[model samples]
Target: MSATLHRLDARHGRAPSLDPMVQLVAGDMNMVNAAILDRMQSQIPLIPELAGHLIAGGGKRMRPMLTLASARLLGYTGNRHYRLAAAVEFIHTATLLHDDVVDGSDLRRGKRTANLIWGNPASVLVGDFLFSRSFELMVEDGSLKVLKILSNASAVIAEGEVNQLTAARRVETSEERYLDIIGAKTAALFAAACRIAAVVAERPEAEEAALDAYGRNLGIAFQLVDDAIDYVSDAGTMGKDAGDDFREGKATLPVILAYARGGPEERVFWKAAMEGHRASDDDFAHAVGLIRSTRAIDDTLARARHYAQRAIDALGGFAAGQAKEAMIEAVEFAVARAY
Candidate 1:
């Protein structure tokens, strides 16, 4: 293992000193829970092709890991973490399936999207199956509170997706609305992951609240980086193209901020090329130029840093444990990653 991973494992017993994110990677629970996850796959003759394709092309199971690691760091030893982890992963996968369909994306994780290969109908249905299966797994965990958290998060995710669809091409997207969508879609799961850990650990209300905030801030920081990456990154490395947001006429933070800073001519150009779908190759270059001219990339990075710091701050109330350190490392890792 890498030194970072090893350090996390070595400090696992010393709770409140090591970072939980690192422990999740370095310790044995990661392997054990992952093996438990693998067993969920079984023969279903009719659904074999679609199921195989989706599972085989998996992305990082960051959401599930968040759930499992949060519980472990909180001193949870029950196997419920396994089911919760699997449920979170299943929810993430279902969202990906629907997202590919909504974005009409052909590629993800450097491979063909399930929708692209199986067609939208099959992809949507399989996504539904996963959603149902996730709930089934949660139910098997037998905690009504856990069921409620995931259920609420799932609804919020759907709401965020709808908000994105309706808000597309609208030039007047406020920062408030933007945050609303992101919190619901991205942060909700993060909050759920941590909250469930508190529940499993039988932590006090204050501790649960702190863990929830940690997840919330971490999630916001994560999506901010993701949105910024859309503007600045190469599709090959990003597993999706640059300006995917522009092509979809969706106003991300950079686009939103750039609009706030644009001259009349720049505004008109964005309206026609981006919101209006009348864009040509030249328009793409122009939009990039405009975003760069305004330093929106830097602006977005500053905002990302703010959220990352908030995420770190949330851990302070904890007893300076290894889990808290891991939480901090995960935030730093998110920020240092290329956006």
Candidate 2:
């Protein structure tokens, strides 16, 4: 990674923001949004009504934006990306709807989760509807390669979810296993989203592979930061309550590291907490102190920086331009959110 691609600069006394990437893809996103709205409509009022509750809710739409930006980087002028980007978003939204239900979560993006409002069955079924709609969009695009990449990603995501479910509350879960989980559950779609842009633009295989690397590493960095935020941030700042992961006994990187580094007494406490034996606010505060004492959060952020740098370096072949700059900054913003 080059020094120039660092997440923070001394010249700018603030953290990086997603504004650049958001601005760069704004116009194209409007088209994608239109497609999403059109496809979300159904004869059964409940389908649209339930889907709209979460779809119209606050989300950065980062997955679709990556597709548009990747297309821009490749200088593709065709409109096929619009529907494809919409498909990418449908895949992501469907995952989110299903995830909230699986996690039994109450809040998302500072709002009540759809599962909480509409019930688990409704949320799960609507998620299925969105998944079907995404496949429809893919078929409409008429690219076997694109369909294969995304459909494979969808399958990998489902497998990752099941893998995480099995690992849940297991304090002994290894970091390597955790990475495999996130790589499939989170980074697979990210990789597919950017790779498909290359397919649509008729770019060479190398460029497709490069974009996949960029999105894959960025997705890992993004998830790392999100996991760190669970310990450092509040509901207002992070859109989900602080310590939710701790209460849920999620074996995120920080917890894994802290458990590895802790003394026997600390390890016992961690085991109890993960087993749902310690869940009070005081217990959570103690867990945070233990994680801090072990330097878990700092090291977690350091790991995030490592992957973010890799993501930046993955774009080395692309020419320096607005699209590349925005893509790089987006990677910066992914890790910077923890600060």
Candidate number with greatest lDDT: 2
Q: List the residue pairs that clash in candidate 2.
A: none
Off by over 4 Å in 1: 1-23, 26-43, 46-48, 233-235, 276-279
lDDT of 2 by residue, 1-339 (tens): 223443333223556778888999899999999999999999989889988888899888989999999999999999999999999999999999999998999999889998999899999999999999999999999999999999999999999999999999999999999999999999999999999999999999999999999999999999998999888845367687888899998999999999999999999999999888999999999998998999999999999988888888889888888898889888888887877
Q: Model 1: per-residue lDDT, tens digit, 1-339?
A: 112221211323333322446455455346534643464455664354675566666555667667666776677776677777777777877888898899898878778888888899987887887888888888888889889989999999999999988888886788789888899889999888878888878888887887788789889888987888777746457576777778888878888888889999878877765576655656777777888899987888788878877777777665555565667778776765643
Each candidate's number of clashing pairs is: 11, 0
Off by over 4 Å in 2: 1-14
Worst 10 residues of 2 by lDDT: 2-11
TM-score per model over all chains:
0.88, 0.96
As a whole number from 0 to 100, the lDDT of residue 112 in candidate 1 is 86
